[model samples]
Target: MIEVQHLTKRYGPFTAVDDVSFKVEPGEILGFLGPNGAGKTTTMRVLTGYMPPTGGKAIVAGFDVFEQPIEAKRRIGYLPETPPLYPDMTVRDYLTFVAKIKGVPRADRKARLDSVMERTRISDMATRHCGKLSKGYRQRVGLAQAILHNPDVLVLDEPTAGLDPKQIIQTRELIKELAGSHTIILSTHILPEVSQTCQRVVIINKGKVVAVDTPDNLTARIRGSETMYVQVDASGADAQGALSQVPGVRQIAVTETRGSVTGFEIDSEPGRDVRRELASAIVTRGWGLLELRPMRMSLEDVFLQLTTQDAAEPEVAHE
Candidate 1:
């Protein structure tokens, strides 16, 4: 539903977004991730036709964003980091105004408004002034306005920012519900939010696309060694010796507790399953196997490794 090829945006001598390219398929939720000053918002603005790119082309829903901006924008719904809101207007009035500007038909505007308000759970605040609502409610109102026109593509920048935990969960669910019918590009700093809500992720650093893949695949790619945490009722030295007997185990470090139980982490060969073998070794050595489990890598680690790895390489100056 969205395609960008060699898109670059510059402000004088500084390149805010540098030769970035990617595709978002229909019904796919593509998570756009990066640290501050990574040009994420600039890219989003270019895609939404709010700003034109200095180089390359972007097409959304079959229309080139630069050559056919009106057509491209007609199919897109965009919500910036701080929602474009009118504080003086009530929720109902604001949404109605947006619907009119978005060219919603007079006959369908009311229905669209109702559907969006219900979907975003802002129906209760319909009559309340936008400025009077809490941050969470105001966010819901912003979401309601964005989708009120029912565009085929949704571009959301930090949609859940500033919301409480409960509100964040609710917003995540709402985004998931909208995924199948809408091609979405979600930009957020919350790694877990992307891991939970998006089918694929694109990691950008310093204005360039560094990594793009499914979350599980990206995690697997960066994982160098498998880890196993084991606890046994024995001396640390004895536990380490027992673990060494397991095939595929590369390294082990054990520490003793007050009750004669030993805690150890065993580094295994990549892609190896050492839990079963470790358990058997503990049993054979006459030590009680208190716990044995494979360690899982967190999304944060994967994100940092990929972004930092790219940044460490020296940049080749582009004319």
Candidate 2:
């Protein structure tokens, strides 16, 4: 588990991370997202013991990162934006060196190294010098090293960077598999990846925590109303008027039309369900109920809404 309390980082007159705070539960994959220059890297650096914060505190795996740097670092596996690879060493030798430094038992080093390299899809490149590897291979090598020791937490900054689409998929699956054993903080600019991979999200802006919640909760909080998409086949009959009569239906507009079938976007009062009423009305009128489903806001929409607004007190989600 990891906790950050009022963590702040400053450089002379500039504050890179300001009073930021959040937590990653044991075995949870938390997505760390922000626009460029939003202090994502700065915060990650402090969390990984790459640098000390100006104020506040960070704890990793039961050890205060600042107070017990050695113990905390021992439990954390970090893959920074750029893979730290030695130019002259082959991938096997490089990982072997890292294994020793990270305290991988000498007896199990070979098996661990082989498993990590294979899982990261870099087994074929084991004999290749790290510096000679293509960007993708280097990134894979970086990932292999991070998990070689199977630390308690993984702090990955763009772990999928430089990977091809297939490689990206593989990495995503691997990260998902690592959950329940490794508490992960995945910081990336890829929105879709966060939505698919992270259990919760922490969106940062201007060095401050802007939002913290599950993706679903953030979408619901930002949307402010319930929206539904409905399609009806009534041969151009005014289905909108019929739909408007349903209780809790606040607004309606046609979104598409194809012959006798028509699609409608409906807005309902918050916490209300109008599907039953809408469906009955359509059936009673003998109009074909083609399609009907809730239209939740996309993660991108939520991200844009939160980041574009003036920084507000972070909307934290609780069970």
Candidate 3:
């Protein structure tokens, strides 16, 4: 588990991470999201003990990161944006070195190193020099080292950045497999990754945490009435009129027409489920139905909405 309380980081006039607080339950995957310069990396650095906070506190795996640096660090496995790798060392040697440095007992070092290499699908590369590995293989080596220590907490910063599509998929699957055993804090700009991988998300903006919630809840909490997309085998104007007759329909735009099928973007009254009524009307009018579904807002929409929200909302404050 990981806990951050009113964490703050400042450099003269600029505050990088301001009064941010959040918790990650054991085995939960938390997605840390922000655009460039939003303090995501800064916050990660402080949590990983790479940098100290200007104010506030952080606890990792039951130990204060600042008060008990070694204990906290011992429980964390971090893969930074640019993984720390020794080019000249063979993959096996490098991972063995990592396991030893992380305090893997001498007797268990070999077994642990081999286990991680296998899990990361890097077994074949073990004998090859790290310098000779391809970019994707290098990334795998980075991931293997991070987990080689078998730490309870894994702080991965853009674990999939710059990888080919195949490699990205492979890495995501590996992280998912590690979820139940490792409390992960994943930082990335990739929206799809968050939706697919994280249980909850923390969105940072201008050095402050603006939003924190499950992806579904964030989108469902979106302001304004729901928008639904409908298609019917009828004239565009006719379909629009029929939908307007549905009791909850507030706004209807006949957006497109392809032969006999007409598409409509309908805004419904708040908290209304007008699908049944709309369907009934369409059938009664002998208009053939084609498609109907509510347009759920994507994670990208929620991210843009929260991060660009009016500044009037209070920023999380720290003493």
Q: What tens-digit string does per-residue lDDT give for candidate 3 at 1-319? A: 8999999999999999889999889999999999899999899999999999999999999999999999999999999888788999999999988888899999999889888998999999889999898888888899999999899999999999988998899899999999999999999999999998999888898888887888777777764788889889998876776679889889999888898888998899889888898888898899888888998888898889888886925333221
Cand. 2 Cα-lDDT: 0.91
lDDT score, candidate 1, position 198 = 96
Q: Please rank every candidate by TM-score, starting with the best.
A: 1, 3, 2
Candidate 3: list runs displaced more than 4 Å. Answer: 258-261, 312-319
User: In model 2, where is the ten-residue run with the lowest total lDDT?
Assistant: 310-319
Give the Cα error of residue 173 in candidate 2, in Å: 2.4
At residue 66, candidate 2 shows an lDDT of 90
- Can you list the residue pairs that collide in candidate 3? none
73 Cα displacement, candidate 2 (Å): 1.8
lDDT (CA) per prediction = 0.88, 0.91, 0.89
